[model samples]
Target: MAISEKELLEAGFSNRDVDTLLERLSATGGTMQGFIAALSRRFR
Candidate 1:
C-alpha cells in the first residue's frame, strides 16, 4: 500500500518538511537503514 500526502500531513509534518525529507532520502540513494539511523540520531 502506498502512503498518501494526506497521511503524512496527518502525522504532523508540513508539506515542505515532507518534501525535504523525501529529497534527502532520494539523495541517499533510497537506503532505509541509513535513513533510520540518521533519524534516530536526529531525534536523540
Candidate 2:
C-alpha cells in the first residue's frame, strides 16, 4: 500500500485498524485516487 506509516499514525489509527481498513478498501475496489476523490466529494 502506498499509504505511508506516518500518514496513518498522524490520522490516529493503530496498525491493526490500518490493516483492517485497507482490506475493506481493496475488497471494495478502492484505490488511493478513488479514495481521495470520494473523500473530497463527501466532505465538500
Stretches of model 1 off by over 4 angstroms after superposition? 1-4, 31-44
lDDT of 1 by residue, 1-44 (tens): 45556776897989997788778878877754566576679998
Error of 1 at 35 (Å): 4.1
Please provide TM-scores, in order, for all candidate models, with all chains considered together.
0.54, 0.56
Clashes of each: 0, 0
lDDT of 2 by residue, 1-44 (tens): 35565697788989897788679888997776676577779998
Best by lDDT: 2
Q: Tell me, what's the RMSD of every candidate?
A: 3.7, 2.9
Relative to the true structure, how large is the alpha-carbon lDDT of every model? 0.73, 0.75
Ten consecutive residues with minimal summed lDDT in candidate 2? 1-10
Clashing pairs in 1: none
